[model samples]
Target: MSIEQRDQLVYVDNGAGDEPLSTREMNPLFSSVLEARLARRQVLKGSAGAAALGFFGLGLAGCNSDSDNDDAGDAPAADLLGFSAVAVSTADEIVVPEGYSYQVIIPWGTPILGSFPSFSVNNTGNDQAEQVGSHHDGMHFYPINDSSEDGLLVLNHEYVEPRLMHASAQGVSLSSGATPPLVGGLRPADEVRKEMNAHGVSVVRIVKGANNQWSVQPDSMNRRITALTPMEIHGPVRGSDFVKTLYSPNGTMTRGTLNNCGNGYTPWGTYMAAEENWAGYFTNKGDNPREHSRYGVPSGTGRWAWELADNGADEYIRFDASIKAADATGDYRNEPVCFGWMVEIDPFDPSSNPKKRTSMGRFGHEGVVFAPAEEGKPVVCYSGDDSRFEYIYKFVTAANYNAATANGSMLDEGILYVAKFNDDGTGEWMPLVYGENGLIEANGFTSQADVLVNTRLAADFMGATPMDRPEWGAVDPANGDVYFTLTNNTRRNDSNLNEANPRAANNHGHIIRWKEDGEQAATTFTWDIFLFAGDAGESGVENNKGSDPNGNDLTAENILSSPDGLWIDPDSRVWIQMDSGWDDPFGNCAMLVADPTTGDLKRFLVGPIDQEITGITMTPDQKTLFINVQHPGEGTSGDQFAGGSYSSTWPDNTPSTRPPRSATVVVWKNDGGVVGS
Candidate 1:
């Protein structure tokens, strides 16, 4: 890209000139590393009776119905289907408890298209279509009815690494920093296209056989959707002025989905890929500073220098939000508004255009999760904002969830609400409806489209509670309680901490959960801290109950920090995943299994150095578990060539044969038995 344009590039950043465009601030550390453990660890130093343990009844541990054991400690863990908790491992490998076997099922650059060629160090623009995208995240398995060994695997590719990509046959790379280096005053059109094609979702058929072996059925129902794929806009905001782009003046359609992070599956058998951190991708050179700033779009340039492409077609110009047109219909100024919604995709039918469900309000959506479904009741979907001091939101579908009629239709129309946690242990789900709040034309909201498009503003105006950094959420299928990971907030000061978030300058994150008052669809609820993830020795700061309500202090054995990805297994086991910039006492980012009832937590698996273990999903039988390890070599500042020469070369096992590629690892029991049992 041109010097001026390259200066705005955030993706290839090696951290030299300007801070990456994602943050509203200019601090280089404001990225993921901004929320490091602060020096305020003295808060919980001394003195007190057991603080109000969440939900009370610590003795209920033994009676935890999820486990066959009636006793908490003395109870046979086998009844809980428990394996020996794996000790934290610092070795450069996947570490799981004994009797469990893990295999790398799919890695970045795995070919999935039958006609397309295999990945190479000399990859070209179109090669990504046949390859697995980088940074694999949230995923799920859809069983082919009556088949136990076959299913579909759907996942998201959040972003790309330029240094690792766009290299010649040699491992030498083109970029040195976080942003890609410019070539002849502009990013090569080929490189830009390849990266763009890498930022969507992938679906491939997977089959398991003897020895629990699994591989992708490349010629099967495999498909790839990238940043330029055609998609239709649906729900209340469809065809609204808010989404009027040059490509879709009618506002019913858009091109591509980017930053596909956490994902979900609708009862109707469709996939939901949530768009996150999308604002940094677009920039405005136009007069509409209001709309651009409202979405955190930088004024000068975008994170990617796609505008400087050799092929300056409409596709290239769309990345430049600078005003060049007379109105929104004349250009792509309104494109940013089209993203940040939960996109519904039909995995079974690749012919369908993924629809952006506008009813699910947008704003750095982490992911969406549904409550257990019933034949005739309003369906509820929960999501977190995934920004510091943002909000948690839910969509209460206007239509009841039904298997026969519910073919991804409930997500089309819903009442969107942001959560507000009261100090009294009660929380209210505030409605973000246009008429109910001050969301009227007088307040700049002319339509429901306005309320949904500018959802963050509406939530702020309606007095919704701002959380630390809501990431992923899960609803317990057994009792209907919802859980969310606050995921730490360095920006939070003492003033922001209320009963819900009780730490000043909160660094170590906490898990908060609640039960809806009457039914799964209730708007009001009772909430509490299920657990506080802290340092190895952090004391009774969590309502004085230590980390567990059973009055036990958190240790390296069962401790974790910066909780991110989360999911409740079929057996009512809460799986906690960690994400951080620094190595912790318990080693690198790892996964922990928790008994929600007894507050029993154990480390199940530990990832290699510098990789974040994310995106958890299990088979219908609950015997197989899947998780993603993203950016294995991310922690290093040098050497992107051969793996393990510098930073981390993880699951690749060997240093030279393969690059450290983000991939999905499948964990299952060695013998034919229930996993975790």
Candidate 2:
């Protein structure tokens, strides 16, 4: 089918709680994940608790549904179904399809170190390292070898949910025995401490079974790296005053990687996990009136106001911009300078300290895509900004490869560039080096430090094109074409639409593609809109123009709206994951597989109510699939609580007095063969 013709066959289901683009900023559904974490880590540099307070329970009516198709119930399970689908959206249960089973080998607060005792949900002996942390996000499975029996699972702990992760959920009240009120914002210090330690990555070993199953090996190399963990800094920007702090004492050392999201692994055998939205964790008191003006901290909002929590813990104090010291030497006025770079972890050795590769040029990095490895060639990477109207970026490591040196720290030296997409279907990679490219040009930028600390502003100054809401990205090994999820952008309405993001009220998002010239990731490339998303009925509409894939013209066989997670399987099959299906009549999120070579996309699996389909990975043998179910029943409250009142009593629902928890799941076929083969 032609690309345009294929687009006509698909449709985006918009049902309940589907708000306008502007309304999404305050959408309470999953805002806590963004507001509670991003504001404190990405935008602010201290006291995430206080910064998140300003956004407390700004409920925008959460919940969504998908459209129903008569064929949905009887449709043949896509060839991928030999492998069962597992649900990890809730903590109380781990659900897998019939014939296939799963167990919680590792759960939040599951003690890792022998020094600490097993976890008790009541927070009795929750040792941060020994116990599994909260809200698992992106993850990877490094199979041992072609015939090896086991591998390592390196997972990213995105953030903590105070209510579920700690003994007493913070920012919650006991009175009325109802859901916590949004008014008295800011979680307590203990809650913040638990969250801080929960922000890094975890590495655990897994073994296969005779029945084609997997389980965690407790003494099998399980380890945790928390917020307090010390790490090394590398690349041109390493140890530059931009990273030094009272905590590091050596400008070169930094503590932990926060808000780690989707990840990348090197052909040379290292793990690259991007630290995203990590700027909001610090507190810069609005005291400097001057500093506040420059960084865009709202004056009356009392930026980082929670830094004043009782006893004023040091961890909490770091977020405070109101430094008592007169100079940078004594006070942490410059604390916000430490985060937002891609952190490299050596999953093989638990003793290895993670390294922050600064050449990646800090931003709200959604994902980093590494080009296939080649000797004597530059390492190329593509990244995106999650915020609306933000920019997309790329990086080219200066150090050339030598297959012999493949795993020998490829990130040590590299150059970072921001993408500039042109209206004429072409684009260039603009180098963002220190003292170069008018980077020092003001918007309050005094030096390179300012440029890195405030990367979004830097990209803006460089004239980078703002994308629709770039999320996870994937590079096709078969064709070298890059595919990124723009998700949905409501702001691209009549007043703001452009060739790159050419749609208004874009509920369903499209995928953009670019093929590098002469096989060089550093070279200028040609670009085009790969697909448009909307209901079949909305074809030919303005915002939907150039989007309908099967319209007997240009936009055929395109995808529907709200494209969130994306991954390109080794076979060149493009897997698409969704999150905003609540508005659909179908009543859930879904997973779809697309053939970029043919522009043929088909729905593979759909999730249960109120859950986002995220984090898809495959075992090295390509025989197993692992997926993550995040916030399945996000809106459940005490008043609405019941056996089924919960958005979903997922996995295997049973009688349990436990709050819903997010988790990771493994799925494999009943027979030991290539999955989806």
Candidate 3:
């Protein structure tokens, strides 16, 4: 495919993007550091950022904290760069700001290596080894040197496009949203096989070509991890009966990592590919744990009825969570527990198997981000449980970080703490340890492993504040200030409104940020709303009534809704990406950038109809920026083959010819200058 042509790949994230329809603990610090720590705590606890601060009895000073503050995490003082902001548009093509430009680098089926199988217009499942995974989500670039020309572009394939995956469309069944039982039978085995290979993560070596263009090189380093690959079960929950199955009786190993969504990197140079909405992939008939049902695991046929395949092969049948044998060890009853984790992959070494770090506590992990790494201090990771009313968590390592000793071991011994935001604008991290809290033998906890296995249950017992759908998170590269995207929560109402989630029916979504009390590893912190999504005319409950930590409020010129993907670039600027159905009238989901120092926000790019602007990262030199366009026509209700009702035909902008595909987009400055310049 030419650089001008658009393309897409597929994966399994259970990604809700435009689909339609459908931690921590703290310890007592030594006296030497106590004064500074307390002082820092006071600044966060007492400082006022948003007008919401005064809603609490603890109260804010007459002046906003942004005006009186001495913190780098505060809102920007002014727009540092004078780049023009792109205007909102309903155009079916990608529209970028005037000075910025973009091209499609690796489309859905671009051949990676010469020897690998080529992508066919037939959309056949035969080229599994050679093609890229589907539905690209979170991504990051690992530079091989100081220059940004070459690096391993590691990205996540969040989910698959079943209708688009099969060589031929299932026009009748797909049009009305009928599947398996509803449509009379299971999908073709070939289709299932194609989807199985289209999930997990992809590590491709991309290099800048002679014409200032970039291309993916199918080197030995290029690899695609799918749903059936072998993986080790590591950390607190490893070797427990909760994970034992027919494949891994000892509870030490499992096969594959699917539905891998949000992406992250360790200071030690590794990749974290998280799994979200994995529970629904299985069909649990026998008496299952309550967590399964709470997570939306179906009782009969699942989203896809792979179990109905009559091949009598254990490999495909294992996806069924039902019991088949006499005992737990004899069947796959525990398979559901093996998923819903953040798997750590060593990208530099292709031979190494990825490990699921259970110590981080598994529960609908949207993304896991680390605080700025300090050689001797403990490393902290923040994550969000991405369901409505779910809670946020952070993990604190027991061992300090050292470049030499930092392997996956540090993540193996961390305490998972859930957040509880008080109306007073202060929040505490409640430890999710089994014995220490209400999780005990009488309540079904026998070891620490149980706590990790049932992390959601543990958080529920500890009274972690439920939040809007917390999706992606990023920490400022320069400081420990952290930010998270609370993607719209359709179910929120006045009955459940809280100080942190100020809105009743929060459809537009918002972003929340906090500065760690001392460092990333601190146990307690204060937080406030950074920006709320809606029209500038909005006021009261549905609007962001207050200003950012720097007291900067959002205006209608750049109003947004459903902020999903978020990133902090090397330049320390914040990039907010949007995801939602085409029905939303605010505008097509787009990507926006901001200078935290000046609180200047502007549209960088906008995507096609029924598509989400997600997965963002930048090259080392900050000249090249990468973004993903997912499920261009997710809300199409009927068959495109007959009525031609499919919502989009992207990358291949032709009308009524090619199927829509999810893809990665490369954005660069027209003058080869820094991205927002």
> Which is the better candidate, 1 or 2, if ranked by TM-score?
1
Deviation of model 3 at 58, angstroms = 14
Question: For model 1, what is the C-alpha lDDT against the true structure?
Answer: 0.74
Ranking, TM-score, top scorer first: 1, 3, 2
After superposing candidate 2, which stretches have Cα over 4 Å from the reference?
1-107, 115-119, 124-126, 145-148, 170-189, 287-311, 407-409, 440-450, 538-560, 641-645, 652-655
Residue 27 shift from truth in candidate 3, angstroms: 27
Query: How well does model 3 score by local distance difference test?
Result: 0.72
Ranking by lDDT: 1, 3, 2
Better of 1 and 3 by lDDT: 1
- Assess candidate 2 and give its TM-score to the true structure: 0.78
TM match of model 3 to true structure:
0.87
lDDT tens per residue, model 3, 28-123: 111232233234335544322233433433333221234334665745454445577777777677998777778886666666653676655465
RMSD of each: 5.7, 12.5, 7.4
The better-scoring model by lDDT among 2 and 3 is: 3
Give the Å shift of residue 277 in candidate 1.
0.7
TM-score of each: 0.89, 0.78, 0.87
Residue-wise lDDT of candidate 2 within 119-144, one digit each (tens)? 55455322666666665667778777
